[model samples]
Target: MPIVHHRKPSLLSFPMWLGTRVLLRPTLSLWPLNKAGMAGLFLIDRAFAAGPKPSGVVRERMTLDGRPVELIMPSGPSRRDSETAILYLHGGAFVVCGLGSHRSMASRLSKETGLPVFSLEYRQLPQFGVGTSVADAVGAYRELVGERGYRRVIVAGDSAGGFLAGKVVEAAAQEGLPRPVAFVGISPMLDLDVGTNPDRSSRSDAYIPQNKVRELTPLLDRGPVPLQGTRRIRELADDAFPPTVVITAEGELLEPDAIALVETLDDADVDAVAHSYSWQVHAFPVLTARHPETLHAIEVTAAFIAQAIREAKDADDRKDQRAG
Candidate 1:
C-alpha cells in the first residue's frame, strides 16, 4: 500500500485570520512610507508593546564586540556539560525591531530548547547597511564560539535576521571560522532581487507590501551595483554550509525566497529542509502568544538542533575511535 500522510489543520482559524487581514495587514502596509511615516508606525508598535513580558527565562545584558546583546537562559535546569549554544538574530527589515521587541520569541526559544540564547541587536539601515549587520553578527558569533569556547553553535534568525544568519555563516566560511552546527531561518527574506518578479508582488502577504522590497533595496545594497546583483549563497563552497532548516508561510510573499534558498542548499549538497505553513503569517513563530503552528514550528526547530548536535558528536566519536 502507498503511504498516506495526514496533515494537521492550522491554528490560524477564522478569528486570527480576520484579525491579520483587518488590523495587522493594514499596519504593515505602511512599511514603505517615508521616514517619518515609518517612525510613526514603529512608535505605535513600541507603545502597544508595553504589556507584560514573557517569563521562565533570565535575561542578562552584555556587549559583544561593542554591539549590545542579551543572553537569555532558561530558568530551570539545563545541559551543563554541553558546549552548545544558540545565537539568535532578530528581524526588522534591516530597519526596525531589536532585542527588546523580540525578547518574547527569544525567551520562548530558550525555554523550549533548554539552551542559552544570545540575542544580538545588530545595527540597521539609514545609518548601517548589510555590511555592518553581517559584521556585527559575525563578531558576536566569534565572541561566543571562538573566544568563549562554545564548541557547538546553532544560528537562528527571523525574517531579515534570517538573511543575516546565512550571511554570517557564509562570511565565517570565507574567514576560516568554525561553522555552526546548524541554521534555522524563519520566514527569511533571502533574495533582495525578489522585487524583479512582478508576479510576486501580488502573491505577497497582506502585511508586507511588494513595493517595500524596492524601497528598502537601495538602503540595504552595499555593493557597487544593487544588492540584487550581488551573489548570496552562490559564493560559498559546496561543503561550506551546515545543515539548515528554512521555515515559511505559504501566504507570505517571501515564501519563494525560502523555497529558492532550500533548493540552492540542496544543489550544493548541503542538508537543507523547508517547512511551510498553509495559512500562517510571516515569521509566525515569533507571535507574542504561541499559536498552534508556532508551537509546532518551535518543536521542529528544537528537534533539529538536538539531532544535529547528536550527529556531530557521533561523528566525532567515530573519528576518535578510528584514530585510536
Candidate 2:
C-alpha cells in the first residue's frame, strides 16, 4: 500500500487536542454521534489511510509467497541475546488497513521493548479474503521463527487485526508449534457472530458502523476462498492459545468479544488480561504517544511482554540446571 503524507499546518496539533477532549468527557461515553463525531473519525481514517510513516527502520518487500510485508525494527541495539520479537497485525475491519497504517505504533512498541517487529500487510476481505491473509500470516510466522531463528515470538494487533492475532496463535498451537510467548490484542474483534454482544448497538452512537460488522459476518463465515486453503487457519479452543493481553474501549461494540476472549482464556488456563479504557475510541491505544489512554495501554502491554520474556528465560535456565 502507498503511504500518504499530509502537510496541513494544523495536522499535527488538531487530532491530539480532539482526542484529549474525547478522552476526558465521560458524557461522551457512547454519546450519540453527531456529524462532528463522524467527521473526526473520517479525518482520522483518512490520515491512517494516507499511510503516515512511523518512526523506525521499516523493511518493506514482497514475501516468498508474493504477498507484500514490512519488517519494522527498533532503531537501537538491545543488551540481551536477541530472542524476543513481535508479529504485528493491522486492523481495517479486515478490509482497508495495512502495514503503513500501523507503522508508527509498531515502531514505538519496538522502542519500548527493545525487540524487532514484523508488521504483516496481509490480504483482506472483498479483494482477496480472510483465508489468504491468514495463510500469509502463518507462513510468515514459520519463516521468522523456524528459519530465521527468532525465539519467543509474540503476535500483536489492533481491532480486526487483533482477531487475526488470536487466530494466528490458535493456528500455531494446533500445529504443535512453539506458540508465541504472548499475544496482545487492542480492541480485538473476536466473535463473528452478530448481535452476540449488546454493547454493539451503541457503536453507531460512537461513530462506528456496528451494522457493518453484522453485514460482514456472512462473507467472513463463507471462507472467502476455497475451504481447503482457508481451513489452514484453525479456530482453537482456549487451551490452544498463548498468554494474551486485550485492551479496549469500555463502551465499544467489540467489548463482548474481548470479554469472551478473557473468559475462554481463563477457562483454558491461559494468562489473559483485558484492560478497559474509559470513554475512548476503538483501538484508541494505537495513538498512544499523543493520547494518555493509549500511552498507558502501551506501557501495560510492554510490561506484560517483558515479563513473559523474563519468565521464559528463567524456565529455560531452570531446565538447563536440572539437565546439568
Candidate 3:
C-alpha cells in the first residue's frame, strides 16, 4: 500500500501533456454530461475504433450473463493458461469508452499475463446509471467465476470501471459468492463521495471536474447497490476484499481514492500496492503504450495478476491433496 516509483525514460511527455491537458481536460471538464454527452462519448469511441488497433491479439464477441463480452486472446506463445482469465472493466466515467476504446489495453493485459482478457460491456449512463452498471458487473463476475468455472479471475478496471470492479467484489461477498483472486484499480473512482467534497477543488486533477460529481453520483443510488450506509474500506479486508494493486497519476483527482484503498487494505494485512506516477494523464494506462508510465503500470498490474493466479492455484492444489 505504499507509493512506488519508476524511472523509465519517456519520449512522449510533451505530446501526452498536450493531449490530456489541452484537449481532454478542457473538453471533459466543461462538457455537459447529459444525454447528449452520451452521444458525444459514442462519437469518441467511433473515432478511436477507426484508428489503428493492437496487433497479435485475437478478438471475439460473445454473451455472458446475457450481456456483451469481448474476449481478447493474445495470438502468441505468451498465452500459457486458459484456466484463468482477466475480467476487465473499462473506465469512461461509467458513460463512455466501451469495448472499442479499451480493447487495446485488454489485449496488452492478456499478452502480459498470458490470460484471456474478457472486457465486459456493462450498462452505463444516459440510458443506465451507476447502480445498473454495478449490477451488470457483479452479474458478469458471478457468471465467470461461478458458472464459467474460472476460480482465479482478476477483476480490474480504470476510472469508473474501477468503481464497478470494487462494487462487484463487495456484492459477491454479500451474496455468498466466491471472491475474486485479486483487484486492480487503474486510477479508479472508488469513493462516490469524492464527487461531493468541495475540498477537492484544490486538488490538481487533469480532466474530471468537481461539478460532474453530484450529477452522476446520484445514479449510484438508483439500482441494486450493495454495502449500504458504510464506507467501502471499513470492512472485509481479508475476506471478500482481496489483494490489490491500484495505479494513479500523481496529483490527479482520483489519486486519493487509490491511496485510501491501498492504505485500508494494507492496514487489514491484505497485500496491496498503490503506485502514483508524475507527469502522466489520468488513466494513462488505458492509452496502452501511449506513455512509458502507462506500460509500467500495465506491467505491474500484469505481474500482480500472474502472482495471484499462482497463489490461488497452489492453494487449490494443497486443498485437493488434503482431501485426498
Candidate that would win on TM-score: 3
Cα lDDT of model 3 by residue, 1-324, tens digit: 166855443777557755677687777667786678665678777887788888978889997888999998888566367668889999888778888898888988888877888999988777776767887888899888887888777899998888788887888778888778889888888777777866565146666666676667765565444435233433445534888998887778878767877877777777888888877668888874656777778888888887887888999899899999
- For model 1, what is the error of residue 135's alpha carbon versus the real structure, in angstroms, after optimal superposition? 1.1
- Model 3 residue 69 CA deviation in Å: 0.7
lDDT winner between candidates 1 and 3 = 3
| Candidate No. with top lDDT | 3
Superposed Cα RMSD, model 2: 8.6
Ranking by lDDT: 3, 1, 2
Better of 1 and 2 by lDDT: 1
lDDT of 1 by residue, 6-29 (tens): 145454544665577679776665
Candidate ordering by TM-score (highest first): 3, 1, 2
lDDT of 2: 0.66
- Score every model by TM-score: 0.87, 0.77, 0.91
Model 3: colliding residue pairs: none
Q: Which ten residues in a row have the lowest lDDT in candidate 3?
A: 227-236
Q: What does candidate 2's lDDT look like per residue over 1-324, in tens digits?
A: 011111222334346435544563343335333334323443444577476566655455546245566666666554644777888888866666566567778878877777878888776655555666677777778777787787779999887787677667766766777888888888877765533445456432233455555555555543454323222121453565677778877666776667666767777777777787655667776654566666667888899898878877797789889999
For every candidate in turn, the CA RMSD to the true structure comes to 3.6, 8.6, 2.4
lDDT of 3 at 60: 91
